[model samples]
Target: MNTPQLTESIKSLVDNIDREYILLPEFQRDFVWEIRKTCDLFDSLVRNIFIGSIIYGKPTFEITVREIDRRPRKGEGSRRKLKVISLEKNEINHKLQISNFRLILDGQQRVTSIYRALKGIDEIWYVAKNEDELSDEIKSKELRDRTLEEMLYEFSLQEDPDRLSIKLADAFEISKGIIPDDIREQYFEKLSFIAGMDEAEIKENFKRYYTICIKLGELFNSEVLISYYLLNMDNEKFALFFERSNSKGIQLNFIDILAAKLYKGFNLRDKIDELKDKYHPNNLDREIIVRTIAYLVSDGKDIDRNYILTNLNYNHFNRYWDEVCELYNKVLNFLFNENFIISQSWMPYENMVIPLIIYLRESEQKDFSQMTEWQYEFIKYWYWATIFSQRYSSGSNEAIIQDANVLKSITKGEKITDRVFFSRLKSQIDSYEDIYSYSKKVNVIYKGILNLINYDAKGLSDWNNSSKLTPDKKLEDHHIFPKDYIKQQFKNDDQALSLMDCVANRTLIPKITNIKVGKKPPSQYLTELKNSNSKLDITLKEHLIPNEIIEGLYDEFFTDFLEERSKLLFELIKRNVIDKEKSIIKEYYQAPKVKGNIKIFATYYSKKVEATFDIESQKILFLGESHSVPSATNKAKFYLTGRNNTSTNGWRFWKFIDENGEEKYIDELRKLSRK
Candidate 1:
């Protein structure tokens, strides 16, 4: 039996990372932690908060993978790229000793996070305070809620040792160069300081404070404790350990684990990546593919984890891979035809694709039109109803089982009457007012609705040129009343400001048009449009724009104008597509109070704020204040924009939860909240 080894310093781990002695396994998921979370992790380290241990393993055979340089992503908040500095090949091989490097099984997030921050690749900072002067806020327990920006000042390092000492002293506001003589030799040796008479204090409080303030370099010192398990084993045992080790931090996802285990000389992840590059549809996650294959083999009775794991053979995967890919192609085509112009953002519910794929596979129909009229109507009704009602918002596996049964029966030539379809359905959208805007583009009914409007847009660019809305074609959602105009009209009315987000104010236009139309009143843009195109009136009418607003008559009364247009848009959809059905009594599902560690990110008015829930205490520390769910939301808002008594929904305001699995939103948890 081989024993695992533990390394006890972050500096050592980082040194290993710098020299390329550590390499991420190909099966490791992409670094998906939001920039804000990265900042919080740094804060934890500076405050000496216990982030869990890391795990690593040395494989028996060699494998090749590139070191993940923390490439800067859009809106990452960090100005610096957290990617590691390049090292010479000789240095890498020499430091590594062995021919192959160790694979980080766990703590990739932590390692990369620290590397990014300390290397200044990620722009993050800790609050600096002089021990002598402490504000009331800093003294209180609530001070912990303050963000790094709120509490810390950004500074630069000096190369000259004496100058650096003076720079540090000035930053810390050490006036008169006051220093206790007894501790001067230990704390102030490299620079000059005034004697504070005969001071024989050991563990001097001021010295300790200055030490922490000037210890930013220690992040690279290899002294901060970081425990990791290093295992050396054969590929089979290593793969098994890889799949089932269940090492605490950053556990592998199902696909990640499955990919680590080779199936007939092919890794599932590589095959999926190849499929993704080939097919490239929005919302095509590995889990979705696994579920589709799982359902295909089980005949829709199960999409269980064990079922997927056991059935992921090359032969099984190869047999169903192309067909599953074709089914997804069909799904996107059907959505495109419906004017959903399928992008990940425009997709209302990914699981909604499952039953349709099951129906297509069972019915042997390549397209919806190939289905019997009754069958086509049956599946269409189910798709829309499931989306509008959000029937699977909770991601209940049983719901997929039940929904698939209904579609399979339809494929069997059992007529799905409106009564039957409506029976399983739960909600109806009588008007566009039912839709709401969220910080994220995914998982919103409004996104689906926007695609529907795009369908009616008929691919006409704002300039009246032929434009096809596709994944490649950039389309922008233009505000009918520009935000500035709305703000001017409504001032501080929260309800009215929120109206700016309503579907009524938005229309699909080409990205160029959206940019050019900036802040122009609808009438002014329309006037310009009429000058350029003979059919401006026809284009506006087709887009569901009310004639009065386009004609420049009711431009000033935009509030009433938006309300009337929403009704008009609702009527347009009803007149074209929908059949009468009663709305379901919508039930909300709250995420069970997270049982373990959880991190939440909230965005308000384009600024991001983060909070962490202490599982044991059931308290969330937001912006520096510890509180319950309700107060966290309020505090997050205050920290984000510094406004209080502002109307906001905690459910909607606090957007994302970075639990171990798929990112979930508080809004979804609310709608899916158990009774």
Candidate 2:
């Protein structure tokens, strides 16, 4: 139950103890460290030692002691009973036992190095060879002539006499001959001085610290036990303590923790090894991939150190394992099939959050296929656009996030479709005809498009537009139509020279190269292509022109050449537009709904009647005078009465029908009025 400080002497004595007693179960994570990082740690240690700084704060080592029935390893055939000690400390512990204990952690590189160095195990040490040593035989051969031991001995005697001399001398007589006199004398002095020392002096001066062994009267059993208690009590507290106490300043990257968590779950370390061996021989750095994943998932949020740690512990492993596997496979597939090169020129923007939206939309819509020339053009334009925009150029994580959100919205079927967005972009380009004006607008549009692509254009622009490029040189605005040829042969005027400065006539080239190509027609370059053995010329011939020409052909030659190159550039811009449109449409909008009824109805009304007119009395009152005038009054009256009766008896029937088929009766009592 108690913890104790294990000193150098006790640690050495405990080296004889069983290693198994301290090792954790298979559930414990694998040891992970890269060569570069390990080298850095050693460098730091050396620096601290030389600078006379304290290497250890609380303790130098930790030893965990546990009692359990011994069991055979997972795949072993024999159920061999054995006792072991485990060195669980993060730092080096020279005192731990090699036999009964297992190195539960931090022992991979150390154990390998120690086993090779002390046990004299054969291991290759890749070192640079002198030009004389790298003869055709050695250069051409797949396997080396000498054993690793011999090579190591050679390296030691030749390069590192202080450590390797005694071992080399014992192993081979040739080493003694190679050892310099000064080195030989130093080695002899140390050996003789040690040999002459009494037992007490030897114990005081040359004793190894038993830093892992437990003492009887200390507060804790071992540093490992205390570490376990501290870590298990509160993980963050343990991390903070570890960060502070580990004065070597060996900071663990987020991916390291993520890798550890993954190893804890499914032995992912082995899986990673398999992936590396079969797919990427040089395993992608864990930090790079982790950063990429964070960028992909976070939508341009800044990934802080603590955030990285938290993600590595939980979110990263849970969210990205399958995605990582898929991406790796996709990348490998692309590489194997000779797909478009994932050039580093577009690394920042291409790998941003918005690009993830593009990828997801493309994947979902089944738009992505094997690389075609057009796809290459599209990618190139997108890359160029993003680079020009400088979206990734500033201290604006929020801007980046906002841009990603916009991209996501577009991809999710929002207001802007790819076509509209691209049309607007191209419009912006066409609006500015002058070269400088065009360049400035294009740069702005480029940034806008980059924002759509989920990249920080400002950031990228700043970096790319820095004065790091030689100021003695300006980016040459090459006249595809040779300027002198245009002026002298075409017009012999300033107007033609002005035309040569047009964007349509210009492309970027190194200023020095531009000066060299001055006044010469394409014919001269064509001739150089045909005559020169340089592969650069050959490449230029294929890329620049299809056929060789004579000097006088300049006027006709460059005209055609500029026209074609301009057309090609125009096509590239067009394709970029199409891709952007596609990205937008895929991210937004839904289909329309159906309806059943189509017909509609309206009502009709009859004209209003005149209320002043009397229907029955009017005829009689007006007829009074006429009746009196009529000589055959009796005959007239009888005729009138008969006519009125006949008219009244003969009523016609009419009906008004509505759209829905309901009918209404019409009045037959009144005369039809024209006025």
Candidate 3:
């Protein structure tokens, strides 16, 4: 067998890592070393022990690379003037320069541990003992000393000494060929004494201690601790080598998995940076892209971690990637223009964007600007209802995937047969009747309510100030009733503290206005507003604050204000979001003019079934419950035939009497009213 060779020194490896010179690939998992592991690794290094080799791949072609997380990463100014290189097969931009940088393919933990220790950036104060210089008396004394920490049991230092053992970082400074004066002198003087030095013993210990540090420097500077054989293969073979060496070593992240699996095969990071570069400061979370891709591969299944990683084929990532990026921005841009959530922080559930983007990809409404009012309304309804209902709060992966399916059906013009979805949504949204119960601190739901109230925010302006809320203006979630007022009125009542903070009494006021209105009673602000402007009504209406609710704020009935404002906001949501749910059908037809409830019937396979067409709501009523024609038909079919069918054509299933008293299929009404 060939002998194993070690060439790279620990100091060389640490010195080689700049963000660019030694590249940590975007595919590598984050630094996961505990402080103990860091201490142990450095302990081994200072002891002249083998700390393992770190493999580096010098790619011959342009590839994605990321900076060390602790170092100044991509946006923190380690960014080069380099354009993102396309790594898709047959699509490599040959004109782009392929920079020479070594990608660390293995032993990231050991490398990062030693690097952080020497740089003095890590948390653990790594203290090492020169075991060769220590005598049994010092060791025994250190062990039994009450004041000495157990960390450096070999060092019999003075009581309550800040440093127990010699600092490894100071010795590392001496390891360099160009030693700083402060470092060398400080290190040598510290080694002059192990503990309290008497004049008699100090001279004898000096040579032993100096030799101790000299030996430590020699060991640290030795070019034998870290060594690597360069991976000089072409891109294809190197990625394979990377997989074999590193894939299972760290806890796997799906983003890193795709970046690794799709290395040079597709350039996952390039596409991500493309989207981010376009959005410019609206940095989309990478997992959103992963989830969208997972949904593409999943084909209407549960979108959990196992399902995603197991089923993700980089081949399937080919066509859908560009479109997902485009449509995701479309949703974001719409939210921006509508004044709902201009930035990601305003979004309550970051994961909610996944189902929404997936829905847009599957939905027929591609352009938000061109959408018909009803099409736009459906999007708003889904968006607001999902938020107010906390639809993605628990079992979020399944919930989001299921909602994507429901949205997919709507896009396909298939009836929304999800009774469970809508019923749960309505129930949850209704429970917000007492808005105090659903939230804790400033959680997703709290942010969601702020986004919801932006429904009529076009005319939203500051109170007692004529300056309107523009795109660039900063905002504060101003308290409607001043905190001091609420506290004084209900000083002992604990509920007032939270109620005053709830969304019902909160609106996005200009930050400047909030600063001015600080601690001022609403009565004071209301009088100031009443004196300055006659258009106060317009501003109040714009914020969805009912005029009566404003009166409660003015009179200092803080509890009454929260209660009434909560009801008013809930009612507003009902009108703008909840009641608008069924308006999705307005895309295909005008509401049918069947007076009252029309009874309809359908039968198959010796089984006859009856259903009611509620003329008022324009939805089918089966067994006294309201459902779409498809839902009612499916239920009736399951009742008669025991077969669960999701794809039944609702319009062709039932017969109803028209105003002409002619028995006709409900399909006729669809035909007559088709837009």
Top model by lDDT, which number? 3
lDDT order, best first, reads 3, 1, 2
- Residues 408-518 of candidate 2: C-alpha lDDT, one tens digit per residue: 443433332222223222223322221222221123332233222222111111111222222123444456557677776667443344345445455334455566666
lDDT of 1 by residue, 451-497 (tens): 55655565434545433446655666678788887788677665566
Predictions ranked by TM-score, top down?
Answer: 1, 3, 2
Q: How accurate is candidate 3 locally (lDDT)?
A: 0.59
Model 3, residue 567: distance off in Å is 2.1
Quote the RMSD, in angstroms, for model 1.
Answer: 21.2
**Which stretch of 10 consecutive residues in model 3 shows the poorest summed lDDT?**
154-163
**Where is model 1 more than 4 Å wrong at Cα?**
1-252, 280-284, 304-307, 342-345, 365-367, 416-421, 428-433, 436-440, 455-463, 466-468, 572-579, 582-675
Candidate with maximal TM-score: 1
TM-score of each: 0.48, 0.28, 0.46
Model 3 ranges off by over 4 Å: 1-271, 313-319, 339-343, 363-365, 372-374, 431-433, 438-442, 457-459, 464-472, 526-534, 546-555, 577-675
Candidate 3 TM-score over all chains jointly: 0.46
* Lowest lDDT block of 10, candidate 2: 208-217
